[model samples]
Target: MIKNHLSQVFYCFIITIILVFNSCKDKINSENQTKTEQTEVSKTVYASSVIPFFDQWKLILGDGSNAGIATEFENKDFFYTQNDGKDNWVVFKSPNGGDTHGTSNNTRTELAQTKKWYPKTANDKLSATLKVMNVSATGDATVAASHSVVVGQIHSADAFENEPLKIFYKKYPGHTKGSVFWHYEINTAGDDNAKRWDYSSAVWGNDFSVVGSDVSTFPEEPKEGIELGEEFSYQVVVKDGIMNLTFTSPNHETKTFTKNLLLSEYTTKSDIPEQTKKLFFPIGQDGVERSEAYAGEGCFFKLGCYNQTNGKSPEVNKNWCSGAETHGGDIQKQYADGNYAEVWFKTGSISVSDTAVSNDGYFAKND
Candidate 1:
């Protein structure tokens, strides 16, 4: 009787073990099925669907891969579509030490317009509604380009290869809000790029000249500034060598700027702004722009996250170099430590016109 009882208990224990094993297996299968379903749902949204202009542009990811004609394409590591419950946005993410473009140390996951046109003869416009999501958190506070990203640009592809417009969003670490500024890189005379310098203009806060005293310290935050994740819109209209820029944000004052691309604003040494002299002259970058700035130059529009943070030593160029942590160029590690830049665009459009539209009352309406 004792043996039979022991046998029955052993068989019961085996049966219970098998039941528990089956239950755990079923749970694992269910979780995997749920994950598959979630992935299927996420695959429905594409970057091209968000902007609808992918066919007219070529994408260069931070990994240095050229995603040509990126329609119906998405890369979760760099370029992808993200939804914020209220709306869907196209996200451009780049690491600080990833692959970069020609001769540029900074990495970018951006869209370059395929068709190039001369600013003098062509009337083109590009507009976008975007917000900067993140910037490199580990960098010297004294560095001007330490925690910033370029969102929009009109890049010249000819004659000295300078940029006429670069919309930037910069925020120092420990600051509540960042500054919205634009830069105009001079087309240096005699094709000498080493002397090329950028003139910065602020739209909502301090310009690029604002910096901290030391590596870890930061300046006071801007009173009227745009915080991370705040929505803003920028419109760039290049009409016959004249560029008109408009920036608009909710609860903040709208700003408008007009520049003639055919004429040089910094033709002589005295034409340099005082801000440039104090900030850039120390770095030996006080070059003057050509008399005809970007005249008849082939240019195109670029929109996305052009990461300004780099791992270069700040001792070389304190203003441009951030000396940020790059983790030996490992992208995964850099991203984990906030050594990256991210920007998101909800809506964007590009149009070419034979006629120029009037921007009348642009400044007066804001005032």
Candidate 2:
């Protein structure tokens, strides 16, 4: 009987020890999982994380300042990451009524990457997948914004005040359709901004030159246009002085365009517009146009929401008045109330190499 009692006690003791050991191990694992969650929440997702060749680019915020050299993942307020239940996205936002870079009333949260190339530089490409969310709503409805936001730009880094390309998305109020257009800003021969004007081209609808005379009017609706939240992509390939653009959509047709950046088509007096002739005639800018164009200028690329909206009312000037509403520079309220521009990019790449880049996603599974 004594032996039996001792044996039972021994079995109970062994079981008690085993249970305690298992419980502690489970607690440790639980703590570790919690820590992992917190860590992920602390870190920000970056364009480099989502796109290929992120190291080759740098970010510039709306205030005409560099976000950084692109080493850090994010800038606190101007640039950051957001997840919309399906995927993580890099958000570029800027206010309508704000300070701007030279010769621009609009502000931008954009990324710029310089390439060692001239006007006739070839085999350089920049591509991205993105969508534009909102633009300024208080401007003249008859102007470009009845609804419009600039989504992409190709700017010259040299002293020439020229932009090789500017991509625009515009929609009218109380409509579901919108248009996509691009413009090539003329290199005004010298630093004379008064003699500058852009040559507009159409991708999905009317070009930059198509606009209503007054704030209450709007251009014709684009028969085939992309709506807000619709995902689209654009690829810019500069080869031998010709800029070849390819725009794609999941449900829409894929379109391509080509332009010559080496030669200036608007180099003569007749090329000057009647509007610039009337307005700038007093300034004596009618006889000046870029003779060689953007040739040999070290041009750069910029991508982001360059808010086309301004504080001026449509009643003020149909051309410059975005007449959109403003929230007194309150970024939080503006973001929440849809008073600003927001753009998202899933993936992008810049290939300076002469070889073609593959379409494979480097961080496809990271989401």
TM-score for each model: 0.86, 0.77
Write one digit per residue (lDDT tens) for candidate 2, span 1-367. Answer: 9999999999999999999999999999999999999998767576566664656655667765655446546765567767778877777888775656555666778776634456565567888888877665455655654356777878776665368899888776555677788877777766567656556667876665566656657667677887777788999988878899999988788889988887777777876666455434554445455677777776766787787776666555455567666676666666675667778777677777443232112112110
What are the Cα lDDT values of the candidates? 0.87, 0.69
Give candidate 1 misplaced runs (Cα > 4 Å): 1-43, 353-367
**What is the Cα-based lDDT of residue 224 in candidate 1?**
94
Candidate number of the best TM-score = 1
Q: What TM-score does prediction 2 earn?
A: 0.77
Weakest ten-residue segment in model 1 by summed lDDT:
358-367
RMSD of 2: 7.8
lDDT of 2: 0.69
* lDDT for each residue of candidate 1 in 220-332, tens digit (9 for 90 to 100): 99999999999999999988888999999999999999998989989899999998898888989989888988886778888999999999999988788889988888999
- Report residue 202 deviation for candidate 2 (angstroms): 1.1
